[model samples]
Structures are given as structure tokens and as C-alpha cells.
Target: MRAKDVTGIIGEEIAAEYLSRQGHEILERRWRGARGELDLITRDGAQLVAVEVKTRRGSGYGHPFEAITGPKLARLHRLLLEYCAAVHRLHERRRVDVVAVVLSGTSEAHAAEHLIRGVEHLKDVS
Candidate 1:
């Protein structure tokens, strides 16, 4: 796999671990539909959450969370609805969350030093 893809996989893994620690039950990973993909789908109590994972090597372009644009958010919302309908899961409350994972540096040493240097969880993001 490409380095970018590997980075994303690592990011998702880290995000999943973080969410699990936060008491969120992971329902799915890399949930795909006609619209697009949701990195993680989780159940937090009675609320169903659709999570988007953004991974970055550094801040050369921007923060990992900055990659989530208005259109991208809209697509994620649509995907969530589609996923709900397909699974026949009725959720009284639903939300969109973002898991931003930033690595320490671009060098291999940095990558080996810390898989994820920082992680930010933004809940109920629109």
C-alpha cells in the first residue's frame, strides 16, 4: 500500500483506540456508501455517531481537521443517513464527529518514535 494509505490506516486505528477508551463502542470501520465513506461509526450510549478521520504527516498544508470541507461534511451527513437506512437502525440522536490525527514529523525516525503525536476529537461537527 502507498504511504498515504498506510498513514490513514494508522490514523484510523489510533482514533478507534481513543474512542474505545472514551467509552464509545465501535460499530464499523471504513463504512462506505454511494455518497462516500465514514472512517468510523460508533455508538455512544443512545447516540449514534459518524466519525471522520483525517491524518496528516505535518502542518505543511494544514491541520488534519482542516481537510474536512463544507461539501465533505455534507457528504458525510448524507452517508450517515444512508447507513442508518440500510442497517435499519433507528437512532434518536445522531451526530458527526471528527478525529484529527497528526504525526510528529515526516522522517522515518519521527514516524517510528510516535505513530500519533496528537489527536483531536471534535464532536457534533457540521
Candidate 2:
């Protein structure tokens, strides 16, 4: 796979781990619907959450959260609805969330040294 794809996968995994530590039960990862894909599906108590994960090696380009645009959020909202319909959870409480992950290192040689620069979770984003 491409490096970008690898980065995304790693980011999603990290986001999942982080959420799990925060007491969220992960329901799905990379869930695709007719509209788009959700990076992670989790349950926070009685509420269902759809998470969008954005990862970046560095902030030279922009922060990971900066990638989530207005149109993107709208698409995520539609995808969440589609997911709910598919899982027969239309009556459950749901909300959209974003998890931004930033890594500190850039080279494969320094992979072991690479650390998570930050993890920012925004709830009810849409």
C-alpha cells in the first residue's frame, strides 16, 4: 500500500486505542456506506458515535483536523445515517466526532522513535 494509506491505517488504529482507553466500545472500523466511509464506529454509553480520523506526520502542511472540511462533515453525517439504517439503530442517540492524530517522526529509520505528538478528539462535530 501507499505510504499515505499506511499512515491513515496507523492513525485509525491509534485513534481506536485512544478511544478504547476512554471507555468507548469500538463497533467498526473503516465502515463504508452508500455515501462515504466512517473511520471508526463506537458506542459511548447509550450514544453511538461516528468518528473521522485525520492523521499527519507533521504540521508543515496543516493540522490533521484542518482536513475535515464542511462538505466532508456533511458527507460523514449522511454516512452515519446510512450506517444507522443498515444496523437498525435509527432510534439510538448518535453524534459525529473527529479524532486528529499527529506523529512526531518522519523517517522509517526513526520509526521506533516516533511518538504521538497529539490526539485531539472533538465530539459532536456535526
Each candidate's number of clashing pairs is 0, 0
lDDT by candidate, in order shown = 0.87, 0.90
Looking at model 2, which ten-residue stretch has the lowest summed lDDT? 105-114
Q: Candidate 1: lDDT of 29?
A: 97
Root-mean-square deviation of every model: 1.9, 1.5
Regions of model 2 farther than 4 Å from truth:
108-113
Per-residue lDDT tens digits for candidate 1, residues 3-122, read 778778889999999999999999999998987889999999888899999988888869887888999999888888999988987555789999999987776433445556799999
Question: Which candidate number would show the highest lDDT if scored against the true structure?
Answer: 2
Candidate 2: give the clashing pairs: none
Report the lDDT of model 2 for residue 78: 87
